[model samples]
Target: MLSLGAGVQSTALLLLAAEGVLPRLDGAIFSDTGWEPEQVYVHLERLEKEVATPAGIPVYRVSAGNIHTDALDPAHRFASMPLFVKNGDGSVGMIRRQCTDEYKLKPIKRQVRTLLGYPAGRLPRGLFAEQWVGISCDEFTRAKDSGIGYALNRHPLLELGWSRTDCLRFLARRGWQSTPKSACVGCPFHSNAQWRQMRDHQPTEWAAAVAFDHAIRSGAARGNATGSPLLGQAYLHRSCVPLDQAPVDTVTAHEWRERQGSLLDLLDPEDGPRGCSPWTCRSDDHDAESAVAA
Candidate 1:
């Protein structure tokens, strides 16, 4: 099974499998966070109709729940995202992220178990499935073992010595040049350019992200249990301000300097197009408070 993120790297893997360049895949599993930009869903549909389906591969859609809805519900035990926090003492911090594990990985693992014809608990001995991940050579640091014995993680891209550039080129040659990075619409890890892209071209999703940013200002609910309320406000943007009012349009001095250099230097190492995958989350080493300070 291929862990299809519907992003550049994963999409390339899917296409390779479809074209028989890679081994035939039994299926592709996309674990939806329910807050991805509309383009991701559209791309998934196109892949299913024009690629995967034609190649005799099934695509499975699984989800634990709608992350946006769950985060807002007072009754739900909110799985926290790494929301930028502003304290009354004028210090910045971030909530520890659990959304990736709960919303993304758990559902995909459950589906894998079911596909393996085993119950939710332990898998039978000596029976494991080969699960392909889409980590490329450029992002090799993100690659790791599956940890679980039931599913062995595979990195075909790394084996092929492919990079993100290679994936983009392959897709562009196949007439899929506009594949959007796959991440939740309200992901706090979004760079200013990504936010600007959504704001300028995808206003509906941008508005939704803005509203979600505002809604989470008071921080996540603690269900019906009695607990200390959040001492500071939360924000979706690294600026620790409201998303709509963030400095998305303003080119920072750092960005300006990078823009003056070669094309490769255009991407900010700290704030580039790091799409979130179920296996390779973009928030790996992100420090929201430090980002705000910088």
Candidate 2:
């Protein structure tokens, strides 16, 4: 099974399989967070028409409900994404994210199990499924073992010596020139440039993100496992202000100069550079806790 993220690299991987450059896949799985930009869904349709159908490859989309509600739902008590949080000490931090695991990985695995005729969470002895992830050569460090006996992770792009730039170039040659990065609509991992693009080209989504930013100021009711609200306020923009009013359009001269190598650069936070899957979220990295909110 191949994971189709609908981003450049994963899309390229799917195309490669369709063209017989890689192993023919049983099908591709898309784990939607349910808050992806509209363009991603559109791209998925285009892929289905132009690639998946022609190749006789099926594309399956799975999700554990919409993440927006799942995070805020009091009954589930799932912690909301740690976008950008404002602490009482006047400093900002990001919440430790659990969304990818809860929303992305688990559902995909469940579907894979169903397809393989395994009972819920039960696998036959020594039976394993080979799963392809889209990590590229430049992101080789993000590659990881599946760590589960039921699934084994593979990175074909890395083996092919491709990078994100290579994937973009390949897609451009195939007449897809504007493949955007894959991510949820309200992902705090987006850079200022990404936010500006959303505001200018996708106003409706930007507005939704702004409202979401506002709604999380007190954090989710289930932010803590114990059902307590967060100690800090949440904001989508790194400035600790509302998203609409945040300085997403322009970076100050000081900010531009300082942001280049600073830890606060939200555009390419850890687990980014490429879109993330549960295996590559880097949430386990101890340093991410200390990094400034995106």
Candidate 3:
């Protein structure tokens, strides 16, 4: 089970596993993207100490890296880059967006494969372990038969017909605390509300993101071998404007709402409350809408 904080689908899976519904809930993993919210870090600690530890389940730490103890510490995380860069005419184009492949998917698959004794370059011809993903009932389309290796892909929430609400109810029954949706603090998937939360509660992080963004004005300009930068540069907080420049309580224009809603619809017409977690969201996904009361 791979969890990004207390998100609904994963939480529900944890509950079901503990109650013997799934039976063999062997590995519990987390992919720390280095820029997660402080609240998420706090909640992960509480979760690890109280419930996860007592359950005797090993919660594997498959992280990209941190500033203090970084391991190759790539500049891009799953949330930092978009898979497809659209042309000015709104047509899709190919761009280098391997954040998910690098930070989330690769590390996880490597760990699982290693445990199965087929680390890399070859598939385990005999192993048949199931690697569970937390995509909900509504997100079954994103569930594909991608890799052909040791473990089979399992989607318990989708099979059980449970929505995000069912997951939350199960968590509340266990007296667990709900934290913010898991993604990097400067995640490009963040909505205006999530961004505002970072700016208000975590000023230093917000500032660091803003400066890091400003340092790389254009797209490739700031990054390697890409273009130079974006037009006004690319800020993590959206608005293209600086993080400090974006108002916390800024009301969305009607046009902005329509455009944003349309984008969400493109990703999944049924998006509600929160967007899909990085673990389950499609690499092609670009929706930034959220549960913030507009």
Candidate 4:
């Protein structure tokens, strides 16, 4: 019961673990941040033969143990972090809450605290795990509670009420339709229609997030983990006129709503950095969708 790899909520948590309803198939994690998005590894290889080989469901990956621990760990070094925007001269837009808590929730709380046996380096004396956080109870307030004791979160699409049209009728009764709403092919929560489908279908991840936003802006600095360099400037939302002039979505549907910012403010953002935290996602490496904060 994990489903943070987000191929239609990991095929609706493997259709509620093939309708047994999650007795135990605790797998499908997918938290690697080597700049993802070749259709998120082709929907995690068609969600591992449709949800991990017909309900075996163990597709883990939380790597990032190189490139200098992924560049001082601003969450797998999307060339220095700090998204969560509104700063089109409105000021006050700072992201980087540690890139989904160190590349997606510390390797999913070290694999659900070693499968609830506990004892990983701390905190396992009380609620001895039961994590199950796919979070689609229409995101029941990002369903938090890591008070730390093993855990105790549990949503299972809000205890089987489910929405987003019951996750599209349980992924079209397993024929499936769409998925791809996870993150990190330059994920500033992409939505100028997912940055025109990653510059019209993955031009090498839109030229590697426009050469990683011009290689972290020529000197690299998103400071203030007590380093004191940033002043709120990083562009991966394509053609705010930065990363080598990237702004050509052929805008003429009335200038594409001034380059997009109000489908209910990118799905209910009053501040910004929108929501998608199945395991641990503040989501980052910006392209420009919006909403997934806290």
Q: Output the number of the lDDT-best candidate.
A: 1
In the predicted model 3, the residue pairs found to clash are 218-229, 218-230, 219-229, 219-230, 220-227, 221-227, 221-228, 221-229
Query: For candidate 4, lDDT tens digit of each residue in 1-294?
Result: 364565455557766675676675666566666566666677777777665668776777765443223543443334334443334475545455556566666777777766666636765356465656665654466667765566666767777777544665667666665555656766555545555666666677788777766544422333433365445455654334454364444433423543364333232211223334545454432333432222
TM-score of 1: 0.91
lDDT of 2 by residue, 113-170 (tens): 8888894856789887789988888668889887778888999998899977677778
Candidate 3: regions farther than 4 A off: 1-6, 66-80, 83-95, 219-232, 247-278, 282-294
C-alpha displacement of 249 in model 3, angstroms?
3.6
Tens-place lDDT digits, model 3, residues 1-294: 444334556656766776678765776777766766676677777766776667776678786554212211234322235522334564444344556666767667677777677776766467756767777665566676537556577777888897555565566667753534566554555555555666677788787767655544444322443333333334444344555665445544422554454332332212222543545553333343432231
TM-score, per-candidate, Cα-based: 0.91, 0.85, 0.73, 0.33
Candidate 3 clash total?
A: 8
Candidate 1 vs candidate 3, lDDT winner: 1
Query: Candidate 2 regions off by >4 Å?
Result: 222-227, 250-273, 282-294
Question: Which candidate gets the maximum TM-score versus the true structure?
Answer: 1
lDDT of 1 by residue, 1-294 (tens): 999999888999999999999999999999998888888999999999999999999999999899999888887887889898989997888898899999889988888899999856667798988999999987799998888998899999999999777877788789887777889999987777678888888999999999989888888765333474677999998788888888887655444543564443322222355688889988753532124333
Backbone clashes for every candidate come to: 0, 0, 8, 14
Tell me the TM-score of model 4: 0.33
